[model samples]
Structure formats: structure tokens, C-alpha cells
Target: HGEDDHGVHDGDGPIASDPSWCDVFAAAAKNVIAEVFAHAKTPVETRRQLQKNKMRREAARQTRRTKVVRQTTVTATRDVQLQNHDDHRVTKTVSGGASPFVSAASAMQ
Candidate 1:
């Protein structure tokens, strides 16, 4: 690729535009791609945050549900114990035992 007498290579006509057009076009393309990617990144970040919040809320609800279940179990156990204690007192009263209700009451206290 030898240059002609007019410094134009390959017998082509004189150049009309800037010689750095390729570099300028490449820089402009890179800028445009970066801007598009930046704009597209917002929704991804927002969706990630939303998913995290949703998981937190679900975990909170599950914890509350588990706590309620545990409390219910404790209450049921207490109720069964009280009913058995009452049954024992009635049996002792009818059978002439030395009144086990007093001991049960004292234990409860």
C-alpha cells in the first residue's frame, strides 16, 4: 500500500473527514453500550431487593406461626395436667384417702 504523490494512499482521493474517525466511532459505541447497560441494571437491582424483602417477611411469618404452635402445645399440656390433678382429688375424696388435694394444691403453689 504505497502512497501516491499527493500523500493519499492507493491512488484514492484526498481525505475529507478527520483521520481518527474509527477511534471516535469506537468510543461513541462504547459510551452508548455503557449507558444502555447502566439503564438496564436498575430493574435487576430493584428485583433483587424486592426478593430479599419478601424472604424476610416470609421468615418473620413462619417464626410467628411456630411460636404460636409452641405456646398452644404448652397450654394444652398444662390443661391436661390440671384435669388429671382434679380427677385425682375427686377420687381421693370419695375413697377416704388423706386428701391428696392439699398436697397437690401445695405443690401448685
Candidate 2:
């Protein structure tokens, strides 16, 4: 820890190409690389845990899908609102151009 965190050295020590030095250098490189990749798994595991926590939090608020939903102010409104169970599509006009896959509403008629 006394030395610089980066690999760069100010030449306070001898710069040598000796085989033993190379061996030590290779081992240190391997250790640092392994440690970096080891920490890499932690973030991924944390994300998975966070997603599971969100799912559990949602489990408490969930009720029957057939129940009426009146909290439009809290949640975003589905493009199409269904009373019972039917899923409908409500087309919205984007002030911009449409996706290349779909034709414009004016063109369709």
C-alpha cells in the first residue's frame, strides 16, 4: 500500500528483465486480474437480489386483476383500459414519425 496504486513506478528500484522478476510480475498481474473479476460477480448478484426484493414488495400490493383500478393518478394508464379481462389496443399519436414497421393512420385509411 505504500507504493503507488497504479503499476507505474518512479524508478526508485532497479529496472530489471530478470526471469524471477518476470515471474513475480506475472503472479501479481494474475492476482489483480482475479480480484477484479471476483468483484464483478458481486454487482450482478446484488442486482438479482434487488430485483427479487422488488418482486416481493409487489406481492403485497397485488390483488385480483378483475378488481377495479381507480388510481390513475398513481400509476400510468394503459393505452387501452379493460373493464373485465379483455386486452385492447389504444393507438396514441406521437407528434413524430411512426416506426418503419407500422404505416401511418392517415395512410392506412
Candidate 3:
């Protein structure tokens, strides 16, 4: 019973008993496993990309903060310079015989 040994039925014939069917199933299983691995890897890659974008955004925000601080410092320095200039003008006008109170009032304005 050579056919009985291979478990081949008369109705199904040689194609059903072929070893190639096992190979086909193995290949399909391998493909499915590969797809599963790829899907599993995707989130890790996406997380890394998200981290990089977050770092970039943080760096840009820090740069904007630094620029604003620098601008505020410059504006403050300019204000001090203008105040000094007005004080000097008030002193000169008082020395030139102008009334001290009027010079002080004009400088305040």
C-alpha cells in the first residue's frame, strides 16, 4: 500500500500529496511573520521621528526666547541713555541761567 503510506486518497490524487504544498505554506507563513515584524517596528521608528521633531521645536522656542530677552535688554539700555541725555540737557540749561524748576519740568516731559 504505497498510496496508503503517503496518505494519498484516490479522489484527491498526486497534487494533494505533493511536498510543494508544504513549501507554499511555509513561504506564506514566513511572509506573514515578516509583515508582523514590520508592523511592530513601525511605532518605534515613529517615536524616534516624533522625538526629533519635539527637540527641534524646543530649540526653536529657546531661540525665540533668547531673541526676546536680547531685544528687551537693548531697549532698556536705550531708555537709560535717553534719561542720561535729558539730565545733561537740564544741567546745561540751569548753568546757562535758565530757571532750574522750568528746566526740570521740561526734562520730565
Candidate 4:
């Protein structure tokens, strides 16, 4: 058994909150943490597995974010293209309305 490390706050005393402690009653503490502090004994394999799981979760999160960003970008560009086409078509119609063909048709009314 060693001192506690959960508290990093230093007091007026000589570093009473040293995190370098590991205590292993059922197992060996030195195999977990080298610091002279109190910590639970964890298996190396278990720790590695937890790290890998975290990495996988992070990768999945990044992939989802990328997909959403890509979809949104594509949709926005498509909308812009549609709007541009609409603007051009409306301009052509408006310009043609002032021509003699449209005026002659209106004069027939």
C-alpha cells in the first residue's frame, strides 16, 4: 500500500497528496502503476482492450461526422445549382416577354 493520488491539490504540508501509490490486495500493485501512490490493480490486457475500444468508438464518431458534412455540402451545392438555373430561366422568360411576339399576342385581346 502507498499514499493516495486522487487528490492533486497540494496542501501546506509536504505534498501529502502524492498520486504515486498502488495497492493490490488480491494482486500485485507494481504491475499496474509505478508511482508510489494508491490505485486499484488493473490487468494490463484489460487496459489495452479498453484503450482499443475507445479508439474504435472515436473512429466511428469521426466517420459519422464526415458523412454528415459531406452530405450537407453536396445538398447545398445542388440547391445552389438549381437556384442558378431557375434564375437564368426566369431571366430569359422576362426578356422574351418584352419582344414583338408577346406584344402582338397581347394586342389581340
Candidate 5:
């Protein structure tokens, strides 16, 4: 039938209308234009994402470095405090060549 030549007449047909050459060409051109724009912006978007990732990595590395420095500082302070406490202790020799076992604290009492 002539109707079949134009397009299917079935009410349940998937296509609403037959595609003309003009419509096909316009659709293809639109796709090509969109691809061109996307291609042009690809490098800019990639560089932006890379910069963000690098910043995040650098921030994490700085945080880790700060934590280690703080921990080392605290440990060094505690060691110096302990050393100071040990340095305050005093030892003395007894008369008649006795073993030098008496501490300054015991002598004070």
C-alpha cells in the first residue's frame, strides 16, 4: 500500500514519523557539534581535576608530617623531663672506704 511506503500505519509502531534526509543530516550535525565542544573542553576539565587531586594529596601529606613532628616534640620533652629528674639525684662515698651506696635524700633524713 502507499501508506506502507511512507511509514507503518500501525498505532503501536515505535517511530512516530519517518526520518527525512534533512532530519537525519541535522541530527548527525548536532551530534558532531556536541562532540567537538566536549573534545575542546576535555583538557581543561582534566587539568582542573588533577589540580584538585594534587592539592588533596599535598594536604594529607602535610597533615601526616605535622602529626609526626608533634609526636616527636612531645616524646623529646618527656625524655628531657625524665633526664632532669635523674640528674637531681646525688650519690656520695662513705668514710673508711665503705661502699658508696647512700643517696643525698637518705643523708638529708
Candidate 6:
């Protein structure tokens, strides 16, 4: 009656005590481990690819930023040069051109 209630018990012994059950369990565990490793490997490779893409995008963005900065710097330099040129022309006209006001003041003196 003790063995009859336990349905897993074969004529020889319990199914848990079978050597074939141990082999089946071991094979199932190995398969699970292999699947885990396979899943792990895919993510690592995907991460590496993602990282490389990120780096490439960053590099491209940096290049574009540098180009913009260079263009702005060139424009600013040109504007400064034009301002200096205009200032120089104004100084020359004030110093070298004869003014009627200056002549009249000198005559009064």
C-alpha cells in the first residue's frame, strides 16, 4: 500500500532513483546552460556594435561642430579687419584733409 500510493515507483525502484532520470536531468541542465551562454553572447556582441556606432556618431558631430566654429571664427576675423580698415581711413581724413574751420581759427589768431 505504501508503494501503490507512490505512482512514480517502478517494479525495480522509484523513478527518482533511476540512473536514466539523472542523465536526463543532466542533459536538460546542460541545454539550459548552453542557451543562457548563447543569449549572453548575443547581447555582448550587440552592445559592442552599439558602442561603435555611438562613437562614430560622436566623431561626426564633433567634426561638424569644429567646422562651424572655424567658419564663425573666420567671419569674426573678417569683420574685425573691416572695422579696423574703416577706422584707419577716418583717421587719415581727419589728419590730412584741410578744414575751413581750422584756417578761419588760425586767421583770427
Cα lDDT computed for each candidate against the true fold: 0.79, 0.58, 0.83, 0.66, 0.71, 0.80
Ranking by lDDT: 3, 6, 1, 5, 4, 2
Q: Give the local distance difference test score of model 1.
A: 0.79
Worst 10 residues of 5 by lDDT: 89-98
Model 4, position 46, has a per-residue lDDT of 66
Query: Judged by lDDT relative to the true structure, which candidate is superior, 2 or 4?
Result: 4
Model 1 alpha-carbon miss at residue 67, Å: 0.6
Query: Among these predicted structures, which one has the highest lDDT?
Result: 3
Residues 1-109 of candidate 4 have per-residue lDDT tens digits of 2377444445433342333422233235454455333223557786688779999999999999999999999999999999999767655765777656555545776
The TM-score-based order of candidates, best leading, equals 3, 4, 1, 6, 5, 2
User: Model 4: clashing residue pairs?
Assistant: 5-19, 20-35, 20-36, 20-37, 21-36, 21-37, 21-38, 22-37
Local lDDT at 16 for model 6: 67
Local accuracy of candidate 2 as per-residue lDDT tens digits, 1-108: 455545535643454546788899999999999977765767877768877988987875675332436565335445334422231121332334454433453466
Each candidate structure's TM-score, on Cα atoms with residue i matched to residue i, is 0.49, 0.26, 0.54, 0.52, 0.44, 0.48
lDDT over C-alpha atoms for residue 57 of model 5 = 100
Q: Best candidate per TM-score, number? A: 3
Off by over 4 Å in 5: 1-41, 91-109
lDDT of 1 by residue, 12-43 (tens): 55544545776788899999999778767778
Against the true structure, candidate 5 reaches a TM-score of 0.44
| Candidate 4 lDDT | 0.66
On a 0 to 1 TM-score scale, where does candidate 1 land against the true structure? 0.49
